[model samples]
Target: MCIAYLLMARKNSFLWLLLLSLICTLEYIVYMGAKPAGDFSASAIHIDMLQQVFGSSRASISLVRSYKRSFNGFVAKLTEEEMQQMKGMDGVVSIFPNEKKQLHTRGVLDSGIWPESDSFDDEGFGPPPSKWIGTCQGFSNFTCNNKIIGAKYYRSSGQFRQEDFQSPRDSEGHGTHTASTAAGGLVSMASLMGFGLGTARGGVPSARIAVYKICWSDGCFGADILAAFDDAIADGIQLPLELFHGNEKTDTNISFCCNDGPVLASITNFSPWSLSVAASTIDRDFFTKVQLGDSNVFEGVSINTFELNDMYPLIYGGDARILQQVLVEQI
Candidate 1:
């Protein structure tokens, strides 16, 4: 009887140990399953590290300011000497002709048809031999003459969604032209002819651009412009450290539209800091002649008429005028 009792005791002990082991294994699996997937903390840490290394701290700001002061002083001295020389010379009518620094506010057309080398394979379109379509103003041939610096972001299947806004890339080159006119680094025929050189040199030369490729390939949807504005504002805030140098002033100019219609009401309501500009060809009427022209002639077309087929009338002409008037009043 004693031996049988010992055997039962040992059997019970073994069964208890097995059950505990099973429970521990199940608990571990459940704990692992409940954990989140990707570790965002790691990425955040890297970003912080980058901000520390290459980013401008207060020290960098001081250095930049000192340098700018010295450079400006030198330029001022030279200008003073020039003025003195002119004063001594005869038949010098005046030294200063108002010397007005023209202020230009820029805008973006939220078109969808931006070309990308990566999308070529996805769409079965095949990659172009070279990425650049042409050069505009500054830098070397290889650097400047290529397509827009950040065309990759504008391709189809990018972050832009149709539900958000409907415009894509530039099919009509209107967006590109508008962008170039606003903040393009390159000089075109207009600049060479002294047309848009001074007052038309855009609001900011070195402003960082954040594009929202919401427009369709052919045309733009007003909703897309609104989405672009929202996205741009969000992106600007999220990566403020990455987007602009700490020492440099943030660009307040927001250029959009082509030439001369009323600013988008939604844009004005949302991004008050941004200045919306409509295309202003040398035409007689407000709602007519949306095509880009050089010195009052349609750029590519030989025929000249106030044709609705060629023009982009404001979506709501009355609304556009009201918005334009409001923007004017604000200025």
Candidate 2:
């Protein structure tokens, strides 16, 4: 049986940047011929082919990223005329714009991450699976442990912001949240400002995490996403994704969707190869004790991290506003 996989970026998604034909220069990803035979480096071959097409000096400028890991392709900045020329070249498969895609808060892919987070502890866990052949690509002040087996970042079609870290250390907490949710170790008594306090853990607490920093301050570019995908496939991670479109009720095999908002037709996954997961609500309620001067105590839903040493005057919001106006008039 023959199987074909198509990689497409969603509309307005961070995955790609759509450029108009009227633009003098635009970014595009070109998929070359099949993988080279034994001992042949796909990257080297891609560079050579690029040099042949765009000349030695221009090739260096035009070439943005090389996809050699599992897929045989490369991303380049080319004009419309040059794109046409590349289309007629030998061993060229297909070419398309590096469009952008929208991003959701619940999924993975974000700015760099914090390795020191407690959820990323690698205690009592065995070494990574023997099939894992990935490596940790860390820079100064950044390192990966057994819990985070691999780390890599990509930026091919866009420029990084001033605050953007080139390394895989997440400045924002989104990457950490998604990674921890995927494979973070169990963290006891975890809560946000003493809310929902309980034993916190990920779906697969024992599983290791491999951080791939594709999204940046601006957004996640298609070329970068493709580069990360290629590297991931080469790094021994298998993402058997296939796209399908139909009614969910009729299509029983369409199993994958994100932890998106509770809305109609919000399930994002359509492929049968992917998995369906939902973030269920817990039964826990957080309440703090409120003690009055009369020694009367009551429990209210709130987050109280600090102790109240003394009782304070409590008044309605409207009354407090009126009092503030009166005091301002006297002043």
Candidate 3:
């Protein structure tokens, strides 16, 4: 009998073992497709019949949950062999073990300040799935439409000003820009200032947006990251997790940065589930500048040519040092 169950599990599904408990005597959660009805009395009657098929007691069977007319189904508890038998019953549609689901820690979005427009080959794909809920406040003009299916925010420390930080309404444009890059509607002749003007669109123009504002100007908190991740998974954002590709690897073409502290791989590196995207360059010549006291100026390399060139005093790394050594240093 043990071998029979093992063979059945192996042949049936990868999910079979996932959903079923290892113990032979433990209860299994089965999803049974139910009959349509104005009232659920018919489904209840089937449940009663299903109960009697076993031992007609709570010890034998129990309905964990039942779906309404919209989705005809029920989740029930039964032993492994009984669940197998339940699959063979006259009105039974399908049965499988229910298992716990987890969220991948990281998800990647392709690099860019974002393009004027991104074109994709979506020959076989259908329209985007709308599977999330929004948390936009009614009093605010910030809205969530069909294309933008979800909006959410998380803040573990209630330190920010209530006016600007009260809701998912993005004040800094960080959240707004990222959301647009992922699923923005088609815009004609979009550009940065008078530069790079062209038709702007997202990688999936038809795809819906789900916003999770886990950051503020200060920075994102660890607790907020967890909250955003939980909501993203619950909202059914099933796309692969993305992480940094350590662009500053100490080698050719990679002008390594010793300024940003010791090199450490982002969490996206360790997980096999993530797709680590390495940053690369384009043909467009961009400029970077470091200004000194008086008229002295040094130019560096970068794609961002739009720095304000504000007259705020520029100081060397030595000039910015403080007497207090509070930051933790690795010996």
Candidate 4:
């Protein structure tokens, strides 16, 4: 699957992912007509349609999630034959394979944040911006501070692993890293193994973070992502700059940065009113030295800052798995 990580400076980032139709076992997004009105909920209508198309037994097994709040749609695992049948079905707008996108280390307003992380400390922060109007919806073991102004989670499938947190608390570090990188607070002497030593900070350290947890262990689902976009827009957060082509300057408030690796058409995060950023080369690099027990030394490019003073056994990647299994058995 392709996962895109976005970083917005002082404002909300507007990113768009292009979906491609391909033959695979991957899940597909089944878009439908506008949400149904009246007492019949959109989710119920979607289920009913699925039952009619695939019958009750098959629909129950194939249906993954239903989109109700923002639009009318559902995600499911469908075969080519089933997809064809769905196309001919009434109320179905379009169906496309949930294509994969590459993920950037920088995160969008996604995942859940680790509120206890040092990067999210609110020691010197003031109240949220005057225009801020968001709320915290953490269920358990999750809280928001001035720095992380808001939090929310979505799981349309109503399924989660035993390890998954039911709240906006990050069990995996990905969300915390991305959230901090976008607008994290200042952290002094922060380094991994004493590397990259400095006061670690984000692009806009003063900006508040509002998280929308849409990803989980099964990977990010298309339905959840769309739901996040819907809520983010409703929360008065400015997103996506729909620009065709121009040399004109954009607004001073919204800043944009993205990689040029992907084709321009594939990336829809363009705006005539926002300045688009281009990548630049770093001024310096860090090198690491590895000293073997045999008194031989090897040098490589790395950000390692920790000083090694003792000799230790080196293990190969393949052997590490066996070692882990042995350790687990012992425990």
- TM for every model, in the order presented, reads 0.27, 0.64, 0.41, 0.62
For model 3, the run of ten residues with the poorest summed lDDT: 107-116
lDDT of every predicted structure (CA atoms) = 0.32, 0.69, 0.49, 0.68
- The CA lDDT at 59 in model 3 is 28
- Please give, for residues 234-318, the per-residue lDDT of candidate 1 as tens digits: 3331323211112235555544433323544423221344455553555332222334433253333333333455534336756
Weakest lDDT window of 10 consecutive positions for candidate 2: 1-10
Quote the positional error of residue 26 for candidate 3 in Å.
39
Please estimate how well model 1 matches the true structure, expressed as its whole-model Cα lDDT: 0.32
Tell me which of candidates 1 and 4 scores higher on TM-score. 4
- Backbone-clash count (model 2): 18
TM-score: which is higher, 1 or 2?
Answer: 2
What lDDT tens digits, residue by residue, belong to model 2 across residues 1-331? 0011112332444323222211346788887644566666666676777677656655665677776655568888777667888888888888888976444343335555689999988888778889898888878878988888889887774467888887888766678887787777788889877666778788888877777888776666778777776777777877532222223345334342555768888875444444566556657767889888899999988777888898799999779989999999999
Kindly report which residue pairs in candidate 3 clash with one another: 107-241, 107-242, 108-241, 108-242, 116-200
**Residue-level lDDT tens digits of model 4 in 170-268:** 777778888887888889999777666789898898877888887776666666777676677667677542221222354343344554545655443
lDDT agreement of model 4 with the native: 0.68
Per-candidate RMSD, Å: 25.1, 10.7, 15.6, 12.4
TM-score of 1: 0.27
lDDT tens readout by residue for model 3, 144-262: 54454456665554567644555666565555565565556677877777567788876667775566666555655444553455456556765222221212333222111221212
